[model samples]
Target: MSEVVLTGVVKRYGPVTALDGVDLTVPAGALTAVLGPSGCGKTTLLRCLAGFERLDAGAIRVDGREVAGPGRHMPAHRRRIAVVPQEGALFPHLTVAANISYGLDRADRRGDRVDEVLALVGLAGYGDRMPHQLSGGQQQRVAVARALAPRPSLVLLDEPFSALDAGLRAGLRHDVREALRADGATAVLVTHDQGEALSVADRVVVLRSGRVVQSAAPGTLYREPADQWVAGFVGDAVLLPAVASAGAARTPLGTLPIAGPTTDGPVTVLVRPEQLRLAPASGTDAVTATVLRHDFHGHDALVALRLADDTRVTARVWDSTDPVEVGAEVAVRVDGTVRAWPATPVPAPAAAADPRPVHPVA
Candidate 1:
């Protein structure tokens, strides 16, 4: 396995910058996920690491050897890297064993490396079958096995599980992660699925507009996001306007105690849907809201509500409890200390004037 280090990496296409001053480190034998929206620079970063795309500025090193930099550029074939794309990209004319053993030296190919890799990917005895005969998930496993056959120093997976069904994708993800870890292979996975990144990666690197936004463990990124945008992007959140005074923030929901010292002023409080609890309206301390809608999601339901002052919020409740009907008054209370950010007030829309009815005349 190899450690990849990128410093101030920059790549541009004409006037568009696909990667802008990005710095990242993928440790040896660890799977790091690059997560972002569709147009973000994750794919570009992967290609750059694979030596397929040269950097416009900055440096890239693998195992302390400079591969891409000011006057140094290594060809893709020279790098000991393997790539598994969205599709399997197997050769139709060759059998699974032949496809996996394509690039190895004649002597090495004669050994049992193909079967070993196949076993690693959970396809021990399917080497003789053609790619067309295998299922989609099986075909992807073939691709992964082919990449690992040569014992590459690093592996790059570009949304490898995207084309499969949810069940197949989940299974394949688990199998692939295990195969990589068992082989002690360092990997970088580029994906847009938040759950996939959080569940599979040892560390997550979030990118936006060709720039690195945050890099940390999945739990840290989910619980204490760097900002409001990160918080909203990571999970479901309800932002409310609040005022801080004497270590407590007063919002429309209720007066919530703050954890750290802050300047007394207006702030934005972030409360996740799961933190909001619902109960029958009775106590004066609990805030009252009318149910706007209830969306049943098998094990749990999301109850939409509108406060007395017209503020909207959502609460996730267990489906086993009595179902909350639309327009039913319910009491809502926060269960934990909510996160607050610098206030950025959004101007409410101006009230519309009364519309006078005009009769149509012939």
Candidate 2:
């Protein structure tokens, strides 16, 4: 019955507001990843839901029951929830089965339950083995198995695979998400890895400055973000100068008719590296740029271009395509249409507003 929901949830820590106000809904049996940079309150939000931290204001509900509100706060143990922290946090003194079954309070059905969960996590027959005896990835899998032993309605994973190597992390992410789904357990994963969130989450909730930024499916959030901050956080983006008035956005690509209603004024264009291409010469909007720097990342080559205006941009192209070395002349073209987002109107230094392709991420 636990369909997790949070409305206007806020957490304050000694004059510093950790979570401004967060509203989210995790549908039953679905996995949601809370994604954001460090210190963005993703962990704070998860902790509040896990009943480890008290909320200063707002409501938290599980299974249509209000656990945290104006005057009511539920204790962590009574919340019937499980939290698997980053380091696995396994009990050093206990065997793998003992660690997983430590939370079971009702019955002494530990033997069958432990065996079932172990097999479910692909760690069958490792009951007597101590947590320290297992490999890092195996230990993580054991931790997940332990969280599921008690059969909680929801599982809170705080960067559970952050410590594993890249390859192991990827494999564990898939296996863990599948195991959770197979058990019909709702999960909330808190992580800073964009690829991790995009790959395993049924939906992603992004937070910034203690507030919920954007919440949607992985592809939707990546392709069409709610704002510039969301666009940048969910994936890599290039915000170019553009004009939008009435309905259409006059962009370097072409005049694209508007989708949603937009304010009439100057706006910044948002383009992903995948949406740009290097082509033959064209007119004014087709920028004349010199390939400044490039890097080969196996499947794709990241090419940095310095436009005549001195604006630097990074474009991603397949390695199979022709290579463009540094100092080569190239005309960068916008593949399709780009969205025009209103610029943040706040006073700032000129250098702070400088746009360069600083980070090229997958």
Which candidate has the highest TM-score of all? 1
Q: What is the lDDT of residue 79 in candidate 2?
A: 84
Candidate 1 TM-score, C-alpha based: 0.90
Q: Write the per-residue lDDT of candidate 2 for residues 289-336, one digit (tens) a residue.
A: 888887888789888888777777889887536678789888887776
Clashing residue pairs found in predicted model 1: none
- TM-score each candidate: 0.90, 0.89
Model 2 / residue 341 / CA error / Å: 1.3
1-362: candidate 1 lDDT, tens digit per residue: 79999999998877778888999999999999999876678778888888887889999999998899997889878887888988888889999999999978888799999999999999999999999999999999999998888888788998999999998899899899999998889999988899899999999998877888899999988877766666777767888889988878999989997654556799887888998998899867679999999988878889999999999999999753678989899999999887777786442221222112211000
- Rate residue 315 of model 2 by lDDT: 90
Question: Can you tell me which runs of candidate 1 are displaced by over 4 Å?
Answer: 259-263, 319-321, 344-362
